[model samples]
Target: MAMPEYTDGVLELYEITNDESEDYPEERLKYTGLRIWYRELAVYDTTRAKLSADSVEVTYKLAIPQYKKINSKCICLIDGEQHEIYNIAHTTTKDGFKESELTLKTPAYEREVIDDTERTE
Candidate 1:
């Protein structure tokens, strides 16, 4: 089957790398400019709140090539916003096209504040 061509929008996939240095222990997500075509499946309000605030659930339909690799550890950058990929299901469309349904959750660290207060003895 041939891969379907999508003209909706481009999405960037990022790989999360854990950096554990003495200075900082953080997860670094890097994007290698791997752009692909993806369409928005649905965006609705969720009953659960994220970070003690309201949130929404988003789903995307990605037309990825059969040889491409996508996993749960990957994050999707859409419209300058990072979304965590929770579930990925590969399926063949009725038109003989390979597609992947990505169920994304809101970013975990949306509005993180850094506290750099120093303690004086």
Candidate 2:
């Protein structure tokens, strides 16, 4: 879908990245919080997810390096909880901005992170 003319850009992303080093398995995962603009999407049933079957669209300025870094395997922290980015829909706006509609593997509700120290990856 095409992005709107303007976005308030209030949402945020955890932007997880793996180190890909076999030697340091413990420290192989990394996380980067990314500011984003998102709107709620319809929730549905999906047997694929171990968590809640919910998703959200993460629209934002299409950026490279970081944009190139994201894929189906990538996961991000939403409110400090882990959520998988199952799909990515990229769009170029009329005024020249990049947008990403990121679908997740879990419910977008109750995303509140209880403890930051509980993160394993």
The predictions' CA RMSDs to the true structure, in order, are: 9.6, 8.5
After superposition, candidate 2 runs with Cα above 4 Å error:
1-11, 15-24, 44-69, 92-98, 107-121
Residue 55 in model 2: lDDT: 31
For all candidates in order, the CA lDDT equals 0.62, 0.45
Which candidate leads in lDDT? 1
Candidate 1 wrongly placed segments (more than 4 Å): 1-3, 43-56, 59-63, 66-68, 110-121
lDDT of 1 by residue, 17-117 (tens): 66666477676676655777775564344423341264545444355544247787777777778888866778878877767877677767642212213
lDDT of 2 by residue, 4-58 (tens): 5323323334433334565653222233444454555444434234233333433
- In candidate 2, which residue pairs get closer than 3 Å at backbone N, Cα or C atoms, i.e. clash? 14-77, 62-98
Please give the RMSD of candidate 2 to the true structure: 8.5
How many backbone collisions does model 2 have? 2
